[model samples]
Target: MDNDEPLESKTTEETETQPAPQSSDEMLYCEAEVPTPVDKEKAGRENSETDLEIEDTEKLFTTGQKELYTEACKLMGVVPVSCFLRNMEESYMNLNHHGLGPHGTKAIAIALVSNTTVISLEVADNCIMEEGTLSLVEMLQENYYLQELNISDNALGLEGAKIISEFLQRNSSSLFNLQLSGNNFKDDSAELLCQALSANYRIKEIDLSHNQFSDKGGELLGHMLALNVGLLSLDLSWNHLCSQAAMALSNGLKANITLKTLDLSMNGFGNEGAAALAEVLRLNSCLASLDISSNDISTEGVSKISKGLEFNESLKVLKLFLNPISIDGATLLILSIKKNPKSKMENLDISNVMVSEQFVKTLDGVYAVHPQLDVVYKSIQGLSVKKTILQWTNPMKLIQSYADQKEITILDFFKSLSATGAMKMSAGEFWKAMTKQNQVPLNRSQLRELTKRLEDSTGMVDFSVLSVAKP
Candidate 1:
């Protein structure tokens, strides 16, 4: 004790002079230095930075977005919905079949005014009228992020179309695809739209199908097509376009430089229209796909169209099916395609068109020049092309038998597959239903070929067509 303790021991007098021993906490407090002005400022700044980081990381909608949504809800007399706000974060917002009336549509449009994320907006079958359309037009003026807009099957009449056309004339640079199909647009609306489209150079695709656009409207669109340089695809199918209208559109093709696809199906593009298209095809080489199916194009029309095929080297897909083309006309078509050594044609759909044995032989010879060319036909005379057609008739017959045994019409049979009671069902779903449980004895490729015949451009099979179809 004397050796170890004497070296470190302090005198009693010195310890008393220093002060009483203190605890660790008391020592720390006595020795701690007070923060200076600079130190306090540094700590404040760090706390502020942390708050900002949390705010940015936790916030889902920006201030502008929140303001827009609040305003929309106020105008609609509804409370703000969290789900709707969540959709603001998505790139695509589909509100199809939501029964969003004029007010609802206008509200949604307002909410989208400040959106920076949404690029594709689908508001189809929403009962949108002039008011709703005007709101959208205004929103589009401020919102440039949206590039694709689908407002199909709305009641946007002439006034609505006029509003849209005006907006397009001024602000169409942001849009690449526009769908206005199934609207009640007439000739006047068509004229207005055509004028706007002529001025626009950014839109790549436009759908004006299933409207009331007649010859007068068609003629205006034709002139627009001639002037437009940015449009790559145009759909005028299921409209009231007639022979003169077809001729006008064909003339438009002569001057078009960017258009690659043109759909004039289910119109009355008769022989005169065919002749005009034929002449245009010979001159223009930009178009790659042309659909004139069910356009009332007859033997003479096919004959005239064949002449165009003789010289065409850019057309890859030609759909002349469902037309009243005769064996002689089809034979002439095959001959024209054969003569064109520079032809780049890949698909020739002459379905529902019967051909003679001689035409089949000639078609076989055409394959020598274009071995990759695929021809879709109904049947051949005195010979079977089952290998080529994938046994189209056999599948149809099997479907017909199933429908008969079920004691339901063919249309009903297809309709049964649709869960929504709609007149249409998906091609893939229909294929699965037909092939499921050995209902339709066919492989995947065979079913696909048959389904292609039954499906429309949307890849949906229309059961209504089955009512009048010949088994």
Candidate 2:
């Protein structure tokens, strides 16, 4: 045998000493380890090549071409045909790189086509002056398709914010989202934004977080929520919003129905602010998630929120991260969740709050209960004999089938029912009456005719009962 290799005799002896293959049952007990494929080195090389290609393409855009594009954008509407650059058709035309001073945006605005569907434009990190911002606002008023415009991290003061807000009020542009984060927008700017939101309903999400929006801004936003129903999410986190602002917002929540998600995290909302929000939660029925994490909310605030949860059924997620909630507050929350059947909260983020092991155990116990309940006893109970039968059914389904034959909603069907005084009583009472009177109900043809007449009339049915029955 070679010096580097094991001796052939030794190898043969080792093979002989090894155990033989076991029976099928014993073999089944053995676990197999699969080897992982090794292609990481090859992937690294491929990524390096792709990065090189991207760098090479970026180098192809000459400084002169960029300047030409910038000049073309600046002269957009000023010279009519000057805005129709061949390169602008490809992507966003950046004019700030041409060293055109603070008025660079104005140049681009003057060149842009009115009624144009420019999807995105970035003028951020540049010192665009107030006059330049106003010119851009005018451009926004005429243009329709600009969905996103990032002017954050710039020196856009309250004046700039107001200008943009005013343009936003009139522009029926298909802009659904706006980000003005990191701008120094104070209370006045916030008020302008609120007014803009009230007039314009297309924007669904607004990021006013990280601004200098104090109590005044918070109050304005609260009032705006009462009128603006299209907005689904609002981010006002990291603002200097205090208790007064929080209270105003809470009051607005009482009337607002469409808002689903609100982020007020990192705001300095203490116990009083939290208490105000808790009161709003108790009354509101549409909000599903609220993030008040990283605030100065103390145990007293948490206690208020726990009390509110006893009545709140719509809220699903409540974030209280980094709050000062102690064991007592945690215990109260656990007890509330256990006692309240209406509390449908799925997520309770209490991370960093001081809670005891026993409180955690109590919360776990609450989770252990069955989701549904069964009543074993009632004040009155009845039994039937001799094959006597009764059935409880949804009368709406029967009416729906009749309406479906003619293609109409239950509202239309009820309208026709009113002319014949068929719907004089409440829908529940009418349904009960129908069940008691009809041993064998009307034929399909007769039902269809009844639904058709209901659809023909301008009568109305009271749906207050049905509305109240909804969870």
Candidate 3:
């Protein structure tokens, strides 16, 4: 959760031809993955779990369910990522309870078997079980085309994990970007995958977060990683990987040369574990990004990591958020980064590091001097929907937040609405009034829903929703 891929836009043209992979050993790394819960999206939008809308030009057939799969393949070739094949504006593929039994997996399997152009696929959150995954495995066994496969949030249980791991050990699958996050990959089954990982370097990027990978699983991962040569990015966050696992992974990094990004956030890697990992940063030159955020790393660990940074030449992003690294620790770390003239650091996230206001102000001055080294040192907290609405609805508050010089007030806002000379109005009327001559964030129906929420009895304006003070 520290950093993520760029957001996808639906308006972007889908017909734009995507260049095919150069290597016969097609790489499977891309920006699409398992689906996560988003806001109920815009109010105007219908239920966001509808089927994908294929373009007229991309349709190859219009038969039964088979055509849907064929059309999916036709549209998918436009982008390397199958997830991006979706129209960003439309509702996403949300098949929680409706896994379609065996038919859903067969549809995708048929598409994969027939199409050789498609590379990346994101079929996560479908609650797919052994049958669906086994169906995919069967197709992938003969497939040299599939590079990326995201089957996260499915029911790929212990047996399934063992099955996939054993399959990978045979070098039959060519998947490069494989994400198995949120599947119950427990210790014994996880170890099977780790054993396979020792020999299989075909996978370049993998996400095994939010599973049951603990210190015991970490030991297996560490032993394999020491000999791993092809893996560039690894995400092991939120798996309860404690200090012992951190130390083991750190030991693996000492001899690792291919790993560039490692996310150890949301784990329990304390200072003792971080101190062990610090040595790799000192010796390894290939690592480009490291996320130790949400760990209880204090000054002692920061001091050691800073020493490693002195010798690091390729490290870029260092996320140390949610730690106990107070002002003194941050100051020492910042000074160490300054000493590394060869450091290609683009951003450092030290947010919620228990720093004082004065220390943050000083860090801001440093950030101003070295704009390339952007420092994020803020606390991230959640807000209620009602509170968010109240603040956003206030015209003066919104204008001030945007830093616009146009002096608009609550009175002016009401007067502008009154220009139409109607005290009571429908959401449709309010939508037109609010979106006059400019693009508002809300859709047409969203504007109407907001009007409904704020209007009082007899459809009179609440006025209170728009009464927040400008910052």
Question: Residues 1-471, candidate 3, lDDT per residue (tens digit)?
Answer: 111111123423332333444432232223121222211211121321221233342442443333455334333331122332232222233223323233345445645554566677667776657756766776787668778888888868787787688777777777888888899888886788888888887889989988988899888888888988889899998887888999889889888889999999999988888888788888888888899988888888898888888778878789998888767888777777777767666567887755565665665554444434655555313445576455445443443444344455544454456465454554334544565525234432244355565678544555555556333
TM-score of 3: 0.61
Q: In model 3, what are the clashing residue pairs, if there are any? A: none
Candidate 2 residue-wise lDDT, 112-152, digit = tens: 43324457776655566676576565656555666766666
**Candidate 2 lDDT (Cα, 0 to 1):** 0.60
Per-residue lDDT of 368-453 in model 1, one digit per residue for the tens? Answer: 66754667777666665556465445666777898788777777766666567568765535644654445546643466566777
Candidate 2 residue-wise lDDT at 18: 23
Task: Report the lDDT of model 1 for residue 65.
Answer: 66
Count clashing residue pairs in model 1. Answer: 0
CA lDDT, every model vs. true structure:
0.73, 0.60, 0.64
**Candidates 1 and 3, the one with greater TM-score:** 1
TM-score of each: 0.68, 0.56, 0.61
C-alpha lDDT of candidate 3 relative to the true structure: 0.64
Residue 413, model 1, lDDT: 64
